[model samples]
Target: MKHIKFSISLLLLLVFASCEKELDLQPQQSIGIDAATATPENINGILLAAYDIGRNTSPDNLAPLYNGNYSGYLNISSELLGNTDQVSWNGTFDYLRDIFNKALINNNTGALNIYSDSYAIMGHVNTVLANLDKFDDAAERDRVEGEAKFLRGIVYFDMVRFFGQQYNPAGNNSQLGVPIILTPPDVSIRIERNTVEEVYTQVISDLTDAFAKLPDDNGARADKYAAQAILARVYLQQGNYTGARDAADNILQNSGHSLTATFAEAFDTDDNPSETIYSWVITQQEGTNISNTHYATEALGGRGGDIAITQAYLDKFDSDADQRRNFTYPGEGVSTGLLLTSKHVRQFANATPVRIAEMHLIRAECNFRLNSSVGLAPLDEINALRARSSAPALGALTLDLILNERELELAFEGFTLHDYKRTQRNIGTLSWDDNKLVFPIPQSARDRNPLLEQNPGYN
Candidate 1:
């Protein structure tokens, strides 16, 4: 499951979305930059290309290679790695099976792509930042910088969480995080894993800057609230309840985003629903949707059903009346008896990175924990989401109940493993902080960079 290194391959990351050209980077810079990176259009092209981070050219549909960082892997990988009894990875892809079994080695292709892609995105955004002065308009310049920072902050936050030990707010958190690479590195530069605290601080810095510079309306790219949304999640992960609550409040109150009319209306189409805060749109010509490729059955245009829902996941629902529970279909062929998710059934649906519903959940949990209602009462927030599915509401609530509600609402949208670790809950028999849950630094990376140290337990 080894892969060719992505360090060079990701250098040519700027192309028109309509063209959908394959990314092929060599040792030299492929895109020309004349007279301080030439025109503003060139800068914009580079920025747009940052979202399409497909690396794998593999022909296998079962292991579709459209590896955009914002794709289904972000959520699916988290679901598999921290799986308790909720879902089963019955797929033939060995790399994914390893993640499900918690038996991953450094050479695992899935793990390597995730690790390498995070770094490659950082590198891509760095290029964008370096050429920001190319734009003559001051307002456009600030917006471009904000978007680049947003891209870097989002991937860096994901990298630190997946690659470093879970952050403990009360502790100093001196643990090794992935390197904080602000500038693109050449062959001569050595790298080191910054501390968990350093990475988290950098993420906050980048997002905070993005929040200030980004506009209220910028089409589909990261806007002001988008930065705030990621900041809220970052604050929650770091146990800053007050900060988390405040950020979520900003999104819920002023983002002008709202919930879908029904649970079934939330997905499948491009993330154009009012609920989506940030998304990466995938036209059929742009790239294939990895979620659909893996989550759907052959009849629906996916490979043999790979990811399936389990009875345990169904039991979490309050009743059959809950509409989200109805999003089920019998599995394909050999796995016909199993159940698969209906959330991902289209090949070109947008990969939603953040949703308005996520902010609501964060606000509810933070409010309950602090015993202070910042936006809506905790119970009201929880019930608001439940009402979408016509699920029965409860008269009282506990932290566990709120957390459970969060799980049910965010199913297949990512945030499972992060939530489990943050709440100090175990994945079945495994401890919440099990080393197996953290991805090993890809061996290929270490072979190239001597200064980059590995996470413990993969050796």
Candidate 2:
């Protein structure tokens, strides 16, 4: 149960230094840049540092902000936005209110943190990519490179979804996207935003290359199938159903992964079920539990109910017989009348980033979209997941039915907003094309980098 500690002090020192010639290292903190590339172990440590940053979900850290909370896994209070009757949020935090209201300013702390944190991780990855030649073994070099790129690709994918307009195929994906920092930026260079298409192209290229270079077995780290699984998600987000289905199918058939026997098993604290493709492993000594953000009540070891499930969302589960329904309970503390979920309960539970069940759903939805051309019958795929939950299966599939299934099955895992936007589905009173759907580029970033332009309507 002892956690492995990976230090990034040296890497951060090197990465944040204003000038290359000013890269001075404290004797006890980290190795010099020359010493880092001098050995395979040193370079490998930097790769581990990237993983450490990726795993950070610390509520206090400005960098690598919590994706789940921001993505609507937990409902926080909002003062700027009128109170919603469905879920109670303790909106004392101004930054969270900015997110809830979709009224993000360029200087909002949460927005700035995500933007800064993503690039911080990317900088580390780029450093690893830059020094791949220094790795003594060719295969080791490829493995490291693949893992780093996989991390980079997912980071870019997340950043683009948050900061840019939804990819519109009709418009040729011409909307402004996040600035792509491929190699670490020079101190004097301010990067400009890439078009949405350009960012996607790089994301796909990174993941595709990662899929090729990664080993079949990477344990908790990313592997070949993890790259493919994420690529499926990217394809789905872009409305490329065929590509999504094929990528997902590859994982379902070839990877030795399968759905856990029951719906509850997927979120079990004792072990990571076979369903997980890639996860952020947590231990007693390291990483805070996500439950702290979602569950209310001191009994549940959560803060005063920062987020609660809306009755509207809860009503999506039409069948009380569905085993997944057991995850919910009457809310307490600040969420006294609402409902909360036990999906993330234990302080040491692992956070699943991708799982096989999602792959099947992706395949099913894609097959449905494509009229059942490439993969299994869409009904069968739907039934497979339904069967796990003991929910009755439907004979035919419809877009609404599929989305409802997604809402129930993937609730609180940070998919709702993206799912609604990508499918052009309206959420509550907001239309798909509403300017508020896309966040403004944080003002701090624009102030620091002149080439960075804000998203429309936020100025």
Candidate 3:
């Protein structure tokens, strides 16, 4: 039943993603920001389509062979870039290898895909926001609008992290970030990059509005708690420990979500465990888990094996105690000793973007940092997940214990690069804020929009 809502059918929507402001004509796919051209049905389609676009799960995307921006590399690009040889990128895609090696050029296809695809999702949300008035009922309109903002905020949050400099809490983060485009592309579309601080301010604003306007349960779609969950993440990212703890406390105290019966049970999106605060759905009929294709081997219903596990990762935890390691296995027929992860290997496995498990960690870390226990004691919160996995409980808690717990729990779930940057952990020789750690602005974007500027290292 977990698949009932989003499994309806795949949508073929032309989501426009462009940087050109001075255009001879309005783009053909432009959803003119006018309700006269949009109906209730059309608005609904656009909103639903935005979800698919984020995951790039549906067919008929700009490119069909590989995963589109978010779905394919949502986890890969980030993890690979911060991998530090801990995980192997055996995939044939050179663009990904470029990202991992930090040898990215301005036109690196990997960076371009993520940059453009994120904005494409923004285009969908902008279109939806423009047509909320199409619904006659005021409350319904608010719900639809909240959902749009939820998705738009999500895209912006991701875009700024991948393309712009990391958010700074102590000083003014005036560094250039991605453009904050709120309107759908029409006759005029020139926009400049917003500061990292500005982009985050907008993200928080949008998500705060989403939290206020979104309903408690919108099927498998984003609900009120989903917005709050992302807000908790946003605060955690910005090092607002108080806000992160309070926000996480709100969900933990009232959201009725908890860890699954076991650690592994939380991963099966098909079960739709309450632990999953938000997830990107994948169905054979609706679309595929291309993210899985890159991570799993051919035997586990993925491509020949783009990503494999290294023995180094195994050494991170007590292999005998940590149940999470049990999922790793050697490649079916390869003598090269390549190992695959079952997390994304299973056909049509859903991508988990946020979950209650993360919330427990956030609350724990924030409480530890703030010296206040809002929901549970720091050790209690930490042990909740550890105890679930049967991992040995710590006699006490420290910052390193909390961080290692996060690493153990969120490993290979797309937290690598951002976690490193946030915690100021160096990726080997590269400092946490190294220029190479940042992705360059795609040259194609600069070609179309002269106003945009590149990041530090690309110079």
Task: Say which candidate scores most in TM-score.
Answer: 3
Winning candidate number (lDDT): 1
* TM-score preference between candidates 2 and 3, better one: 3
TM-score, per-candidate, Cα-based: 0.91, 0.88, 0.92
| Ranked candidates (TM-score, high to low) | 3, 1, 2
Per residue, candidate 3 scores C-alpha lDDT tens digits across 26-48 of 34454444532257877777777
lDDT of 2 by residue, 323-408 (tens): 87667777665667757766755556765447788898899899988887465788888988998999988888898898878867
Evaluate all candidate structures by whole-model CA lDDT and list the values in order: 0.77, 0.70, 0.76
* Candidate 1 per-residue C-alpha lDDT over 245-302 given as tens digits, one digit per residue, 9 for 90 to 100: 9999999899998999998777877547888787766665455577777788887767
What TM value does model 2 have?
0.88
Per-residue lDDT, model 3, residue 5, is 38
Q: In model 2, what lDDT does residue 226 have?
A: 89
Model 1 / residue 137 / CA error / Å: 0.5
User: Any idea what lDDT model 3 has?
Assistant: 0.76
